[model samples]
Target: MSITRRTFALGLTALGLSACTNQVLRTAPRGAKPVAELPADLRPTPNPGYTDWVQGFKSRAAAQGITETTLTAAFRNAGYLPGVVDRDRNQVEFKRSLEDYLAIAASDERISKGRAAFARHRTTLNRLESTYGVEAEIICAIWGLESLYGERRGNVPVISATSTLAYDGRRGALFEKQLLAALQILQSGDITADRLTGSWAGAMGHTQFIPTSYQAFAVDYTGDGRRDIWSEDPTDALASTAAYLQKNGWTRGVTWGAEAGPGAPAGRIIQPQEGGPEFSVTRNFNVIKRYNNSDAYAIGVGHLSDRITGGGPLRGSFPPDAYGLTKDDRITLQQRLAAQGFDPGGADGVIGSKTRAAISDYQARNGLPVTGEPSRDLLRRLG
Candidate 1:
């Protein structure tokens, strides 16, 4: 799955805040410390109800067959992360245009890197594809998108993040289940407690599999005892991602979809937005959706994979965005919005929730239609 702004933000925030713990663990290696005896510096600031929640969850986890040692190691210094709650409660608006998404997912630089990475790992990817019946480029596309070819695997402690979300009580059952899965991963000895780090939401490894996803689909591709997705080697993660897609119905030798011109073969067609490049997708496209459950994301992966494998860009021209702005114009709009103190997250030419909210507030104050779409008129007015 491609890392969206929300996931990227979650990763960045988690890593940024974990500086203390990372440093401490670097100097003083953690042993089998009891939850209470763990150093305060190792934990986030606990809320009033957090301790009780942990104790209750401890009992439940014990009942679920997680050993006492596993529970203690997993929760040694865990506490509620306020940032996780903020991210969960207010997910970034998922209004990025396909163009915006591709600008990051399949940028020229990214395509170059993807090609290099594909070439570098061709032998291993070939074997995996032959074994799994999933395409190598697709796996490479996911690798590029999820962690930029292993450039940005997150650094947050998975147990802490999931346990915090579990105790936070908003999505208690889901996070509790995830926390249990994390403990299981620890018990299995793939990765240790200190090294079991990932996104703020607990998506781990190269392709960002959550704890449950890892348990269900992770593979030991290298004949090693561990399905070590965190190591420098990307074989297991890529193989695991392929296994997942295969399990979910990736048709062998079938493409996800393709760009179509006028009078193209009729299938399940999706344009993403009005007057954009159209795709004649297949069941394989839906299979890609199981990875991220977003049309734009699936297309980005498919198209980028195609590009990585030497395919050209779409021939059909995308009409103006809903706001009557071209892709370049949208980039300008994002820059202008940020310049005016309305941060649309990053100036990546995407009109996500933050951008829409900022635009709405601007419109409400200035007597314009509250349409969240960016327009030439809005850009000029901001100017």
Candidate 2:
């Protein structure tokens, strides 16, 4: 995840925002000084409340076994970042249709990059797959989505961003814990305070593991004695992601999901948006959800992984989004269906599995082709 946008993928809020916190310079090596401060104009206006909070937290951190030296390094120049709070407050909810999401998640260019990355990391990925029972392509897919194959791991100062969120008090405890975990990471000598930058939300490294998750799942894959997820070499980060999946019950040899066709295996069918491709997903699909907790996100990972491994695109036709039908139109359609004794679960504008099932049932009852698509024509028929 990019720090400001995708950083929340490490299970922070359901919004995938405000997930982790730490501090290190982007270009500095371990133990090096944090680089040049921001331009005077860009510096956040000093907030005495934030300063007080940091001071109190410093005491608490010391109580929690964080050494003074580590705290000093982590807190140097740390302050509230208004941009972090802005991104958190303005997160778009369910804004992307499945088609839109898939187009970006598994774009041809991304697929090409993924294939090259897969081939490049074949030896290490193969070893990880053999050892951890997680597929290399899946790992690569996450790498692709989280940071564009390490091209954009975020440059936010984890300490400042995380501290600002904690001070913001919307999800104070969570951010505090992340802040403490970051301190532990620093104390462990894994990465220096000068080099610990990540997404604005603090999701660090190649696959964007939050601080706590990094502590639990990060591995020293190259025998470097440090679980360095932020470094240029992606081996440790990739291994850590595989380890995280395996630890969270990613089954060996089990497909996450497959495109639904005739005689597809028995599993939960999830079509994130009406008229989009449907997938019959397995238990492993749920496992993927442990990372980002979104059906669209999990499916994107699975499909992108498939493409990376030479699989084809989804074999379903989907209507383009952005016709005249708005959320109110969808609610009206649902209300009409329910009034006709063909309940569409609820009148929420969002199309979900239950809503799609109801649409299919309504279509079948009317002797129409069972496409499970919500359309103006269908709404007109119901009216």
Candidate 3:
């Protein structure tokens, strides 16, 4: 996902990179944003179990070399965050087809923002590419997908979110490890606890690195002696991402892959969705999977990177869906719905809740069955 996949290898909501969210620009196509402010549910709440768990964890953290002073400061305001638990417990309910994934992952907003961000940060990105031997657009694509050009780096307190998830007893051991790594970051003085914010599941900064991943790979590209991915400047985060791909074995100058065609690169052919366009992926493609192990994610990053470099969208088209509707049909239905005074929310062809509501409202008024699903018959009727 790119839905709340904060570090899915920890098997959290999403981030090797795990899940995604609705906003996608915040991102996973899977795009999950940490809003302008934390919601009430995300704030701290009393939980005796969590308090007790923290005591034990503190002792264990000490055994693992965390200082008593660090623990004291780290936990001064840290506590259980129920919203973190809610987010951890809930995940993307359904699988998204490649087409739907692209619709969100490579949406117009993301593409446009990606190009502008590339130009805005061209110097830093180009410098990182030279240092790490990764493509600038690749780095920019990850930035777009991870935090939407630094606009949606989360605001949740890492200590509270990780500690709460750790004590929630679901992925306790794993998050406890993240909590421990976060403490180490704090101890290293890269950032203060007050400023250590990220997604609820612990993915931090512009690139959404989980604490452990941050520990293993983060870099201080600005040479300011700190990897400050959490700030408005994205130098360190982008370099760290480039470093990750290079260290993980990105073949220099090799194309990730592309929709198979006369111009396609030589590599293994994979079709992620049935009757969809075929892709030929290279070793570098697998390198991207190291960030978030989904074929869809890898494609989203790759395609979005190409688009940012001024390439076109995929020329191939996916077949009709189970609803016996092609994307064009859906667009037509939405246009027709809006024309009839029903709002289908501007015809992106996804047929979300608004489209369903419009369809149902129209159905009820016409004395038809209340099922809001689209069909060829529905399209004809809308006409």
Best by TM-score: 3
For every candidate in turn, the CA RMSD to the true structure comes to 7.5, 11.5, 3.8
Ranking 2 against 3 by lDDT, winner: 3
Q: Whole-model lDDT for model 3 versus the true structure?
A: 0.82
- Write model 2 residue lDDT over 1-383, tens digit each, in one string: 12222344333333222211111112222222233454332235588998999999999999999999999888876777777777666654535566656655777777999999999989988999998999889888888877778876766667787788888887688888888888899999999776787766787888878888888889999998999998888999999999988988999998888889975566899888897778999998888877777788788899999999999888886664464566567778889988988867566555555667888999898899998878989889989
Deviation (Å) of 77 in candidate 2: 3.1
What TM-score against the true fold does each predicted structure earn? 0.79, 0.75, 0.89
Candidate 1 residue pairs that clash: 93-353
Q: What is the alpha-carbon lDDT of model 1 when measured against the actual structure?
A: 0.74
Model 1 over residues 271-369: C-alpha lDDT tens digits? 886766788988888887777667877888888899999988778776676677776777788788778777675565656666777778788878888
- Rank candidates by lDDT, best first: 3, 2, 1
What is the C-alpha local distance difference test score of each model? Answer: 0.74, 0.75, 0.82
- lDDT (tens digit, per residue) of candidate 3 on 154-263: 77788999899889988787888889989999999999888888877788888889888888889998989898888778889899999889988998889899999989
Where in model 2 is the C-alpha error above 4 Å?
1-44, 262-265, 324-383
